[model samples]
Target: MEIELSLPEPDPAEQDREVIETLINDSKYTSFAAKYLREHKSEIDQLIKMKTKFGNTWKDVVKTGLRVPNSKVGFYATDADCYDVFGDPLKYVVHSHNMRDADPNAIPQRVVGGDQLSLQVSDACKERIISARCRFARNLTNYVFPTSISPKDRVAAEAELKAALDKLTGDLAGTYTKMGDLSQEEQDKMVENHQLFHNKDEFLVKGDFYDDWPNGRGQFHNNDGTVMVWVGEEDHIRCMSLEKGSDISSCYNKATKMLEHLDKHVGLAHHKDFGWLTSCPTNVGTGMRASVHISLPRIKANMPISELKDICKKNNLDIRGTGGENTGFAGVVFDVSNRRRFDVALSRCHY
Candidate 1:
């Protein structure tokens, strides 16, 4: 005797409803993605099938947080997804950034050319600061972000930035080195000097950022290495300036010059409600993270790390390890930076 097997057809309607209900009621999961899904139950089918130009569906936006289990705020595929898919959810989420009562639809515009020198660390505090660094993130206009940028578009974008960087004059003159071209030793040296980015980040890994790895990525730094730009890192552009001591003004000014030059030569992505268009909504406004590596031996000796963290939180500041985020501090030295990326004016930022 012969036997035949039959299988029932899959149902998208049933699948969509299950996805919505599961995420909405998941007590262990708390993120903006789940919040949005619960509030928009009627649009479950539309969201399930919706895809941005960069091929980011609602699934892509929430997968990292849902899978990681401990992720905060989750992640975004592109700037468009924030407004088109997760706007209201983000309004509640960003409130944690001290943006209480702020309209997520009315983020301030990008502010540059401010008097960076206006704010100076007092002489006593300056004595403990090892170095100062000011860095900001930027993405190119008319291009998808790094999270889902096509390999072809990646090369084209790099070419555009390289052309503009090649035109730097005076102290800004520097060389752009392709990541794939660097030897292992050379790569190690760059990492040691903190001039290169690595692919060890779990958040970036889960987001598919390292796909087609190093195919169209590079770094550009000025002759003195004070000014630098990481091309095709987490963001399309990671522009920064660093110098010894607490002369944050120098770092800020150098970075501004580079930013203004890029803005004029190659357009930058800017959102009307969000200052800058970036892959992540957390960096939507300003896309700036100005930081300094400071030594706080006395404070460290007296206070526990948890207490220090609480104090930093109270003052609208963030404290990181010497190696940067997700790492521990080196000896008594720490990386102290502003916590507010949006709503706060750049001109008002003082160390």
Candidate 2:
């Protein structure tokens, strides 16, 4: 039975020509900005194309593996500068739904094939790596610029660039460290999880499995030999089978672990004031609290709309309508309690 899924239609009216114009204007300011944005736009277009491919690849991978509801995996750029450049930093907060959620029979078709999906993931990973490299290069740019160009302005720019590079480096290093430290037992556990829906024949026949799965065989099969060919293990090409909440917890865990490692490696004296010789007062001890992205659709519907405004004031949550003044549709920003202390104990307790 063929099913036609109803997809959300794009709103032409919602497109912000002004923001695009502003970005074009902003790009003209610095040679770096102009060159970087040109490359960024190209990368973004490639990312969209890759996403289309990866979406299909992931579906095929799941079909050959285990099926789990709420399984999702997508790349998110976490840097502040990228967020600003993209025009909506908070949009990353929304979770992406899988094809199965949208359409159960959404199998690997010509356009949405496994190869495309893998390519998409590769492209996204590449984009992230490129973004980091660009940030690092920006620091070099600042250093290359002469000290004769106003010490105060140069110093401020240098500090900003350094902070951006440091955060990116720390995050990348932390992820690698966590992955490298994973025990053999832990790796086995992941395999075991995959084996839950394992079919010996299919799992073992591993020659370009993604592109050629079920080729002209014309049907999916199960381990028990049921004619229900749509019964093979769910393919998880991107490891979306894992729980998202758990993923967030894992990220928090890694951050704390890295901080602990840094504390030990650099020693207290070295990082007494977070290694900043002239530290920003705002980030002195524990920096800003964790910020959460929340959808306030109801607030938008009822606004100028003082009722929600009162609530926001009482709760200390910042509310912006539609697009934040600068960028539309970015949603509201809600601050999570607890500043940057990286309370390992609290994180553990929550876990």
lDDT (C-alpha, whole model) for all candidates: 0.76, 0.25
Where in model 2 is the C-alpha error above 4 Å? Answer: 1-249, 268-278, 303-313, 316-351
* Best candidate (score: TM-score): 1
Best by lDDT: 1
Error of 2 at 288 (Å): 4.5
Measured on C-alpha atoms, candidate 2 has an lDDT of 0.25
lDDT of 2 by residue, 1-351 (tens): 999999888642232222223333553333222223334554433222221111221112122112211212211211122222332211221111111111212221211011210112244333222110000000121121120123343334334432332443333321111222345576356346432122233322321222322221111112231111111112110111111221233333333333333233322111221211101111212221222234444555666545655665455433333221223344443222222221122222111
Taking all chains together, each candidate's TM-score versus the true structure is 0.88, 0.24
lDDT of 2 at 153: 36
Model 1 per-residue lDDT at 208: 73
Error of 2 at 221 (Å): 38
**CA-only RMSD, every prediction:** 3.3, 24.0
